[model samples]
Target: MLLVKKKGQGVKYGYQFLRMRYIIMADILFEDIFGVKDIDFGGKKFLRVSRIFCESESFKMELLLDVNTQIYPMELGDKFRLKICTTLREDGKPDTGEFNQHDAGPSRADQFEYVMYGQVYRIEGDESSATDTASTLSAYVSFGGLLMRLKGDANNLHGFKVDSNVYLLMKKLAF
Candidate 1:
């Protein structure tokens, strides 16, 4: 969700309308983590990883994986694909501390955090094609074009696009 901050507004009434952009892709990768050695907030500990390559954009991201779970096989040359729904922080700030305090508790300080809800689609081997790699991976699939066709709106304002392919993928993941 994209949050627009109102000018001349006090902290009580600081933020205005939220514009949400939703992209339905198969999977996302936790490229790198850097800055802020350890993150402990919202009852979860996050290890900040830097130099994340999200599709075409390289961003500094934090992966909130299980603290006990070690990031395996994510080496310098390892390649994998993931499906994820990514969004900018809601307070128009990269740092979570910039937002107003919530009754829930302390907010995270990371600019953005992704909730990994999907599974690993493919693991790249030495023979994998770098150019058409995303398309070749089942997890990196995109539902944008299919969403436009099914809804006939040509714009994906809602969260997801439903189609036969989506159903098929969902079914496959279910089992």
Candidate 2:
């Protein structure tokens, strides 16, 4: 609910009587605004894990890849490529009249799934970043030009380390 107070709308003020009004609304989740996707509208990007830092339970992964203003995979470093595709927009929306679902590329079934394979460059866990207690644990994985942050329990992220091969599986919630 939202409440607005007028200049004279107070209990001390008499008639014209003061009135208090409220506007009610439902809560919204963050995922609704940014839907998950694998290959975004921008052209494909190949990246290498450059650095990884863990602060308490939260971990940050850095990658060496191209950066595009149309889409942001992660916090781009000195390395970066931009391939503009007329069919799709930065937000993953088709460019209306110019977009053709069937063109030249992988089929929808093949590209619909979200899976990324990469070698972990480095990893720091609770022991290195925590002093007292740990809260939420997170893992950041990058695929080409895409970046994904996963939050959950730390036990599930076992075996991730420097030069270790890792597979990140994600679900496409929206087109």
Q: Pick by TM-score: which candidate is best?
A: 2
What ranges in model 1 sit over 4 Å off?
Answer: 1-51, 56-69, 85-115, 118-175
Q: Which ten residues in a row have the lowest lDDT in candidate 2?
A: 21-30
The lDDT of each candidate is 0.25, 0.32
**Residue 2 miss distance in model 1 (angstroms):** 39
lDDT of 2 by residue, 44-141 (tens): 43453322211111232222222232333433211211111212222332334443657534422243233344444434444554664554344444
The runs of at least 3 residues in candidate 2 whose Cα sits more than 4 Å from the true structure, single-residue gaps closed, are: 1-112, 126-129, 135-153
| Cα lDDT, model 2, residue 26 | 10
